[model samples]
Target: MLRRLAAALLSVLLVVLAPVAAQAFVWARSSDALTLDPHVANEGPTVALIQNIYEGLTERDRAGRLGPLLAVSWRMLPEEPTVWEFKLRGGVTFQDGSRFSADDVVFSYRRAKQPNSGFSDYFASVVAIEKVDDLTVRIRTRGPNPAFVENTPAIFIMSKAWSERNGAAQIPDNATTDANFANAHANGTGAFVLVSRQPHVRTELRRNEAYWNRGHVALGIANLTYRPIPRASARVAELLSGAVDFLQDVPIQDLPRLRAQSGLTVTSGVENRTIFLGFDVASQAPRGTEAGGRNPFADLRVRRAMNIAIDRDQIQRVVMRGEALPSGIIIPPLVNGWTGELDTPPPFAPARARQLLAEAGYPEGFATTLYCPNDRYVYGEETCRALVLMLGRVGIRVKLVAQPQAEQSSALRRTPGPDLFLAGWGSPTYDSEQVFSSLYHSRDGQRGAYNATGYSDLQADEMIGKLSSEIDGGRRDALIARLWQKLRGDLIYLPLYHQMLSYAMKEAYDIPVDVSNMPKLKLVAAPTR
Candidate 1:
């Protein structure tokens, strides 16, 4: 009888102490990081995941404003108008205990500009990265760059000693299934240290006891576990069952249900990502299209027709559950140089679409494959399905080919990608130059890495190139507006809408929803009960 009573008492004590002993935060999302190497993949999930481990020269605050991280302060060189200097934060140590210095910044800059690194485009204007001293570094650009300062946050800093020792000096290209040590492992000087990672399964991170900003930031959660739940229903179920504490991408259909659940909070805001459709405009004979020996998308009339055929308002209502903001341009409002007048989507008119198609020599419309990802964007498959029906009404036959995000991204990067495909873009720099340089400019070694559409114009390229070096804010914005006007007139892409992001978490935790959809775990705070 004494033994039984003691055992029962121990069990009750464990139950009472479990919550306090294990203050872990489990976050679930639809997809996993393709690579932990910050320079390998310029993807949202990959960047967000690695951000917890990697520390950049600069970072964005909770309000999305530029702030200090690895670098304490930075300023433009007055004598050399094209140069910027950064003072590295002293007394900082990498997770492995190596002292942080300017050498690591220079090495990281060179590594990030390698051919395999997807972030090379961001540094296209950089002429040189030099170490002035152990604590100071300087970057010389081709010309005055207004966006350089804000763009630093995207370039993650890696320890030179750690990377060289691990044979990860070069980032493996994730597109070709190339694997390097950095692809699966990480070493950084951030608030969190990577404990373990199982690709497409789960990733575990523990608080860094030696974090430089320990008391400066709210580091309530001691541990974090990330689970990739591809299915929306499964993610919702995990959250509802208390198996997960936070969900990054909440489906619009479940917002109300999640909001009504006791002890749950759903924070929502418009994301910086703009979802749109692109075509192989430069391909002479694109595959998966009814047009033989020619590309129908090459015709302005057909492109305009396709643009008007998409009923953004209807998609926003039916498919998105009234959680999307319909847009006419690929750039979101959060980005610099965005104007409301320029973002007005074309009116949905099937009759007009048919007439335009007739004018483009496709009187009876044409059949084409619409490549989409099933799990990439929120309701991505459903959005493609709705697009198919909308185009069908105007006599366009759309064969929907929905695949996983990994496969879709691979296909889009190929020389001749799908004839028509859906893609979502987020401006990490929050600038129009990022959109123009990556999506609209002509494909080159430095720019147009994501221009799957094959849309290239020399004038557009020149304008974007000038926008990068233009120092005057008003002049740069005017150039941006001019480039946007040109893109609008050319109809290079069919703009859809800016995605609406909803983050569901326990009410005890207060997590702010940022436009980038990247919530820094260290900034998350849970009020004491």
Candidate 2:
């Protein structure tokens, strides 16, 4: 009995003496990264996940402001107005311990401009990339690129040594099932190292002990687990059960209950993303539409009718749970060149919509399928269902074909793709040029990589190209305003609403919600232990 009591006393002492466990943050959301390859998919979830692993010459902070990452400084040469030079950071090493240099920057630029890369549009104005020295590179544009600095954050850099050794020089095409070493593995110079990745399920990352900027940023999260719980109910349950420490995409309907729940901290902000609808405007015979061998979306009146039919207020209330800001234009108010007049949504008038449809030679509107991702945007599927009901009221019959984001993205990229689809665009550059070039411009060369709607105008394309080269800020803004005014009349896209983002986490942790909706957890300070 004396020996047992002594043993119990020793165990208690040992427990009290042990140090606190390292902070392991578990972040859960509804969608997973599409690929491990940083340059393959220009998708939000994929980009956010890869950002923790890979980094660019520049990065956007939580407030959507441009800042340096791999590069120490950058400037435009006064003598050579077309050339912008960047000074690379020294002593920075990749996760594999390989040294980073100008060669890697040049190599990454070339790779990102590959035909299969979704980020090709970002380099459309680049005339050449020249490495000046071991730590400096010069980017020569077709002209004086006003938007070049803002666009740098989207161009993630990769290790030249790693890519060559692993034969990942080319980005894998998501449209096809093309797989490369980069598709499954990664070697980047970021604050975190990818430990394991299971597509559509879970991914794990650990903090980089030898991170170059560890002193500058917080390295609180030692171990990070990313869980992609597709179902909203399951995601909330995981957070409530203490299985996940952070939840990124909280369902709108559950916001009240989650806020009232004990031991939880919830913060919300307006997101930079704008959810909108697009159609195959250029297709003569679009797929999934019963337009009697003609494209109804090609008609201006039909497009306008469909646009005004969607009640933004109703959707904001029912589908978004009063959490969304109604928008009339595709670009959110956060983006440059956005004006109050352009953002004011059109009046909801089903009667006028029916009249426009009748004028377009469709008295009892045609049937079409609305393709939308079930797990992409906030209330993506539910919004499409509501759209179906709303359009039906205006005599348009819509069959909802909601699928996973991966399948939906693939379908949208196909030539002569779906007739009607729901899509969201976030301006990483915070400029109207990004929206015009990627969404409205014709799919020629590298300009319209994401222009699935097939909407094109030569004048608009010229203006978009000029926006990249225009040096004067006022002139650029004028050009953007002109484009918005023209595009609104063209009716290429039906603006829905700007998404509002909410992040939920345990009281111990504090993670800020980024306007871009891509949070960099490494910058988050350590939670109170």
Highest-scoring model, TM-score: 2
Cα-based RMSD of candidate 1: 4.1
- Backbone Cα, N, C clashes tallied per candidate: 0, 0
For model 1, the superposed segments whose C-alpha errors exceed 4 Å read 1-22, 173-176, 526-529
Cα lDDT listed for each candidate? 0.87, 0.89
For candidate 1, lDDT tens digit of each residue in 1-529? Answer: 9999999999988776553413678999998888788887788888888999998999986557888888989888888879999999999999999999999999999999776567777887888999999999999999998688887898999999989999888766563477878887888999889989998999999988899998898777788998999999999999999899999989889999999989999988888898999998888888899875779999999999988889999999999999889998888888887899989999998899999999988998889999998877988889999999999999889999998887787776667778999999999888888888777777686788777888878888888888889999889888888988989999888989999888999887878787788889887764454
Off by over 4 Å in 2: 1-23, 173-176
lDDT of 1: 0.87
In model 1, which residue pairs have backbone atoms overlapping below 3 Å?
none
Q: Estimate, for each residue in 1-529, the C-alpha lDDT of model 2 and write its tens digit.
A: 9999999999988777654334668999989888888887889998999999999999999999898999999999999989999999999999999999999999999999886788888888998999999999999999999678888898889999899899888776653487888887889999889898888878989999999999998778888899999999999999999999999989988999989999999999999999999998888877788878888999999999988898999999888988999998988878998899999999998999999999989998999999999888889999999999999999899999989888877776666667899999999999888888888888876888888888878999898989889999888888888989999889888999999999999887778789999999887766653
Q: TM-score of model 2 relative to the true fold?
A: 0.96
lDDT for position 307 in model 1: 89
